[model samples]
Target: MGAPGTARRGPVGEAEYPPLSRRSGWSEGSFSEMKYYEQGTSAERWERARTFFDAKRYSMAADILGGLVEEVPDQVGPRLLLARAYYHSAQLKRAEDQLRVLVERDPAEHYARLMLGRTLQRQGRDAEAEPHLRLASALAGDFAAL
Candidate 1:
């Protein structure tokens, strides 16, 4: 077998949902074909995205979750999962964008603030990360006192 994340479309995923073959007539090229995620009902897609995320297929999860987040902008759960998937996939900018939007929508969301701070830090923007990190810590402390 290959490395941990390399065997992404291996037994579990491949066996369950075989990759769309060229004969099926998708106009997408090879690169897009490889990136194509399985389509299903909303709940099924959510479960698939979660399963992919759990399996460490970060890019696959992110791809699915990104669309889900767009579909349900008011819902924080899918967005958070998308951010996490982006983060793990080394898509720091996208993760930061998602976290920033979450923090803006709900400034009291400590985890989002923390993640925003961390994402910024990961991108080497330490100066910007400081305030968010401090705010996150203060928020945690306040919650602890309650």
Candidate 2:
């Protein structure tokens, strides 16, 4: 066992455990085998995901956003983007789940509520979606929607 402040080294001197202060990207194997979206700093990965999303590569964007969402679970931006990516990719169930989480966290989140309602509607659950859509409209001050 190594000292409390030190990581145990592998036979060739590689760190067995990354230091808590470092933000190492997650990987299953060697660096070369890591996915492109998983190979950069969080900011870089975020930009990459955004670029993919803008290009209409929703599945690829979701692939990157999924990891980002896990890494920054408390960040509403990444979670929202992930949900959008899922929605664009026609992954209604996933989009609904993420949107539900956001709405649960902030009941006044108009965009999330709107997305959740749309997702449910896409899944042929119009009756279940009406309340959320109404609430979202109310939150957005669209009284006509009510």
Q: What does each candidate score in C-alpha RMSD? A: 10.0, 6.0
Candidate 1: worst 10 consecutive residues by lDDT? 1-10
lDDT of 2 at 85: 96
- C-alpha positional error of residue 20 in candidate 2 after TM-score superposition, expressed in Å: 17
lDDT of 1 by residue, 53-96 (tens): 99999999988988788778899988999999999999999999
Which sections of candidate 2 miss by over 4 Å? 1-28
RMSD after Cα superposition, model 2: 6.0
Cα lDDT tens digits for candidate 2, 33-107: 757676688899999999999999999999999989999998999999999999999998999999999998999
lDDT of 1: 0.82
Candidate closest to the true structure, highest lDDT? 2
Give the runs in model 1 whose Cα sits over 4 Å from its true position: 1-36, 142-146
